[model samples]
Target: MFFKPYMRSLAVAASLAVLAGCSSTGGTQDGSMDGTGAAGGVGTGTAGSGQVSGTGMGGNGAGQMASTGIPDVRTIYFDYDSDTIRSEFESVVNAHASYLAGNPNARVILQGHTDERGTREYNLALGERRAGAVQRYLSLRGVSPSQVEVVSYGEERPAVRGSNEDSFAQNRRVVFAY
Candidate 1:
């Protein structure tokens, strides 16, 4: 807890180095964090440019890619301390369910996660329940149970790092890795 003058200087330098390394100029001259040439963060959302959108549904899908060429959306979010899927995200789940039902041989791994607000044991159990909820939803919609495998990481695997609500929102999620 005590720092000499030299140690303090070294600590400051290390902190600056870390901040400098992480400072993204929004990814490009156009201020596009999406790495696309466009200014918007949604990389795949260029009009008639055929870029894949951020969510697989909008940016790249059978329809989006076929018509505009965009791809990939793997994460689905959940409410705080709850495994219930929001009604707003039902379409996303439906899309995956439809895909699995249509392709009998296709399989997907559901990775469940939780924010860092609970005990380790509780988070693990919550993660499992979240994944189970997704699995159940998919099965009810016609995706075979055998085609889905669930894994829970609880608070161990967070997509975002921070103590604020914004970060916590990002951390509570279920990712469908095909």
Candidate 2:
């Protein structure tokens, strides 16, 4: 009951072809051969490093992971009784500018605070001025005006509750919240 040489050779060739096809087009995690996830293996939906199933490509792949959550908050300090942005805070402003530039849909609320010095009305004005100053700086740096909202908390929200210089210094600052 031996088959002919040609028939045996044909059977072997067919088996090899099937094996090659199976290996080349691997199944996804869901057991689908269309490069999608079958159950435990990599997802065929998208090629990414993370195990999470995404519809498209995963992380940025340029060594930077895509932000899956809210962006981190960045704070910048101002001089005592002044709303002017300090030179040291240029980097912080630039970072905010870059973020706003990259994410047009993103927005920030700039809260200005002042130390307990003058009357509440005066402090309010000072805080407002401070927030305006920061807003101008960010605008100059290319951040859209619509992306930033300025608010002056005045002496209402002090960073450090005290009458000392250290507390005042801490209170006199601008906070950026997203």
Candidate 3:
């Protein structure tokens, strides 16, 4: 009877030792569990300071407002072979409107480009169409025509240099310069 009780105690001790070993192994894998590691296992998550760390957006995790000092102006993209301003560009138009409204003296140059697939003259026309489309939008947004200048580079300057869709898409664009 005494041997049975002693054996039971030894078994219990062995089980505890095994558990301790497993726990130490886990600790080695992830030290943050012990609270002594950097970030305290929170892993740089959103802390009340409006700073989101380790979220992979780059910068010092100072949140959206800090990442972009001034709210980014939305870029308006155009469809292939068309200069018509799409509905998606409405926000960009509005943002530009607000900026121009606030800064009356600010002047913008609209530069348009086209993919390399078209003849130079045809691409020039297309580029002009693209710039004109943006000018029209800006005019509609209450910016005076004098404050904006439109120029088309056609196939002369491509934003990207490849026959692929990605490069073509990038090449067909209107850029705003202030």
Winner by lDDT: 1
Compare the candidates by TM-score and give the number of the best one.
1
Worst 10 residues of 3 by lDDT: 25-34
> In candidate 2, which residue ranges exceed 4 Å CA deviation?
1-73
Alpha-carbon lDDT of model 1: 0.56
Which 10 residues in a row give candidate 2 its minimum summed lDDT? 26-35
Which one wins by TM-score: 2 or 3?
Answer: 2
Give the per-residue lDDT of model 1 (tens digit) for 1-178. Answer: 1111122222222222211222221111111232223344332211112122222222233322221211145676654444545433445676777777878888999998987865777678768777777787788778899999999998898887887655666777788888
Candidate 3 per-residue lDDT over residues 101-161, each given as its tens digit: 5577878888887767646886787677677766766676678888888888887987657
Q: State residue 135's C-alpha deviation in candidate 1, in Å.
A: 0.3
Candidate 1 positional error at 138, Å: 0.3
Q: Which stretches of candidate 3 lie over 4 Å from their true place?
A: 1-71
Evaluate residue 105 in candidate 1 and report its C-alpha lDDT on the 0 to 100 scale.
Answer: 84
Give the per-residue Cα lDDT of candidate 3 at 144: 86
TM-score of each: 0.61, 0.59, 0.58
lDDT on C-alpha atoms for all candidate structures: 0.56, 0.53, 0.50
Q: After superposition, how far is residue 2 of candidate 3 from its true place, in Å?
A: 77
Stretches off by above 4 angstroms in model 1 are 1-71
- What does the lDDT read for residue 162 in candidate 3? 73
